[model samples]
Structure formats: structure tokens, C-alpha cells
Target: MREHPNVIAVQDALDAAGAHTADDAPSLVVILDEGAHTAAAAAEALCIEVGQIANSLIFDADGEPLLVLTSGAHRVDTAKVAAALGITKLRRATPEFVRTHTGQAIGGVAPLGHPKPVRTLVDTALAGFRDVWAAGGVPQAVFPITYAELVRVTDGTPTDVA
Candidate 1:
């Protein structure tokens, strides 16, 4: 499972960016015994608060792919985000569009392991947690990272997404 192509890509991207957990440990992707298709499920599996899950969401920002790493406990306020970004139209991306740009399925897009660099916004809400968990390019895999590291690694702007 660790060698899964998607996981490998995620790990390679993490390494290249020097991503680390809150404790300064190297971020290593781990495959859960069961697939965590949602943030609730992932938090339950990892025995952590739902807010600690950094839900990787893909959105269509006026025709371009946009990534938002928001906290599981908060729903993304698209209108607010769009207004803040000065985007004419910001809506949820279709599954096909998400897969096309992220090279990963809807439920498992990592922050940094994409086919191309999508414009990203890290939710300011996520900074409250010491260690946030993110998808590892697949539904069954995840990795731990700090809020600062996540923003830095993805070159994402810190924004209030909710």
C-alpha cells in the first residue's frame, strides 16, 4: 500500500518540499486498514478530532482548478472565498475536472502531489490544530503535517475559507 503509485507521488512531493509534522517528524504516508472516504471517517479511524483532518477539496475558480485545504469541521463558504479572491465564479469542480487536474480521485487529493501546481488556499481555521491529517493521493492513505508546513509545501495562501 505504501508503494501505491498515488502514495508514492504524494510522498515524493512531500520529501521534495520538506514537509514535516507538528513535532518536526518527516511526514510519512500511511494506508489505513479501511478506506477513509470522508473526513469524519478519517478522524474516527485516527482517533482525532474531526477538525484535525485537513479536507482537501477541489473547486473551479472561474475555469481554473483551485485547491482548498480546509478543516473537516468547517464547511467552505464558496461565496466568501470567491469574493476574497476576486474570482467571478467559484464553484465546486466536477469529479472529472478534479481528477484531470489533481491526478487523484475526488476523495483523495493531496495538497502537493498534483500533475500541475493548482492555485491553493489553506484554510486559516486549520492553523488552530497542531497536527493536521491530509489525504495521501488516495482514499486509504493519509499523512500528518503541520499547518505551516502544509501552506509552505503547497505554496498556498492562508485564507479564511469558512
Candidate 2:
């Protein structure tokens, strides 16, 4: 199957950022047989633990887009996050808001390829996994990455999101 335009964008972004994936990686964008829109689905498809799946969640922080790369095994403590970032408000972005910020739907929001850079936070819990899977700009697509590489590629601050 041909790559989706969004998937291509993610590939280009990774290339430009010099992000490294497994040399023998199946594909820059791995198309799953079943939809991997949720962390549980992605984990099952990738045959990895749920904790290894990095969920790219976008939030509305006082009208600004904030990308939060959280671990599948945990839920983000919005209050804690706001306190950490010293922000007054941090709420989950709506579907429309997510699309506007990412140019992709909620389920497939990648860390990169946004119209512009959005402040990002990478969950420190992901450090426990050797390889983490992130959405590849489409529900059926995903890519492998490491916690450090994810932070570097997205220029995300590492923090305890749970």
C-alpha cells in the first residue's frame, strides 16, 4: 500500500531531524492489520507491553497547543502537569482543536510535522522501554523510537506526566 500523505510528512520530519529507528525496521510507517488508534490496540498490534506505547496527546493549555507524550500505562495528572509547567489551565483538547494543531486527527497525532512547533512534554515512564511506538500520523500507521530520541526529535521536555 502507498503511504498516506500524513505518514510521508512524519517520515520527512524524522529524516530532517536525523532521528534514528531500527536499521532493519519493517517500514518507516508500519501499517497495522487492525486499527491502532488506542494504546491497547497499538500494544497488541506491536506485541509490546502497553507501557511501551507512547501516546501523543494534545492539550489546550490556555489556548496554546501542548503536546504530551504520555505512557499508555498511565493517565496524565492534569493538575500536576499544570503546576509543573506553571500554567494556569491545562485541559484536553477537543477533536477539532487537535486537528487544528496537529493537522492530523486525535488518534494519529504524531510528535512532529505540525504546522509549527508546539511545546511538548515526554513522559519519563517511557524510559523503561528499549523501544517505544508512536503514532505515524494515521490510525493504522506507527513507528518505533526510543524515549531519548522522541524527546530530541520533538524537542520535548522530559517530565513525570503520571
Candidate 3:
């Protein structure tokens, strides 16, 4: 089946960023019948540990959109993140806010391909896994990438999110 347009956009973004998946272990985009909207669902579908899933989350930090690529194993500690960023508050972005910022729905927000650059924070915890799976701008589509590559591609700041 042909890939979704949103997924193609993500693939194009990765390519433009020179973030190719490893040639030896080519990372193909997988499409699932059931949406891998949640990190748990994605991990189960990909047959990997939950922690190997990178959950793309958007938050409203001091009225700006902030992207947090957190691990599936734990929840983000908003307080810690806010304090670390020297922000007064960090609240979860609503569906409308997510779509507006990411140009993608909540469940399939990728680290890249936003209409404009969004400040990103990648979880240091994801470094524990050699490879991690992330959304591909569509809930049913997913792709594999290394934690380091993810950080480089997104130009994300590495920090502890949990």
C-alpha cells in the first residue's frame, strides 16, 4: 500500500536533514491496522520494549509550543521540565494546539516537519536503547531511528523528562 501523505512528508524531512536510517539495518516505515497512537500500543506492535518507544508530546510552555520527546516507560514531570526551562508553567497542549503547532494530530506528532520550528527536548532516557521507534506523522505509520539521530535530526536538547 502507498504511504500516507503525512508520512511521506516525514520521510522527506528526514531525508532533507540527512537523517537516513542505517543502511545495514534499513528502517522501513511500518503501517499497522490498528493505530499506534500510544507508546504502549506502538511498542507492542513493534515487538519492542516500551522504553524503546519515543512518545512525541507537545506542551504549552509560557504560551509557546514546546515539544518533548519522552520515553514510553515514564510520564513527563511537568514541574521539572518547567523549572529546567525557567518557565513558569508547562501544561499539556490540547488537540487543537497540537495540530496547530505540529501540522499533525496528537497521536502522530513527529519530532520534525512542523510548519515552523518548535523547540524540542529529547529524553535522555531514550539513549538506553540502541534503536527507538517514533511516530511518522500518522498514527498508523512508524519508523525507527537511533536516539542520537533523533536528537540530531530534531536539533533537540537532551534532558531528563521523567
Best of the candidates, lDDT = 1
Ranking by TM-score: 1, 2, 3
Estimate candidate 3's RMSD in Å: 1.6
Candidate 2 matches the true fold with a TM-score of 0.94
**1-162: candidate 1 lDDT, tens digit per residue:** 788788999999999988899788999998999899999999999999999999999999999999999999989999999999899999999999999999999888899788889999999999999999999998999999999999999999999989
**TM-score (all chains, Cα) for each model:** 0.98, 0.94, 0.93
lDDT of 3 by residue, 38-96 (tens): 89899999899999999999999988999999999999999999999999979999999
Better of 1 and 3 by TM-score: 1
Worst 10 residues of 1 by lDDT: 106-115
Ranking according to lDDT, highest score first: 1, 2, 3
RMSD (Cα, Å) of model 2: 1.8
Pick the TM-score winner. Answer: 1
RMSD, every candidate, angstroms: 0.7, 1.8, 1.6
- Model 2, residue 125: C-alpha shift (Å): 0.3
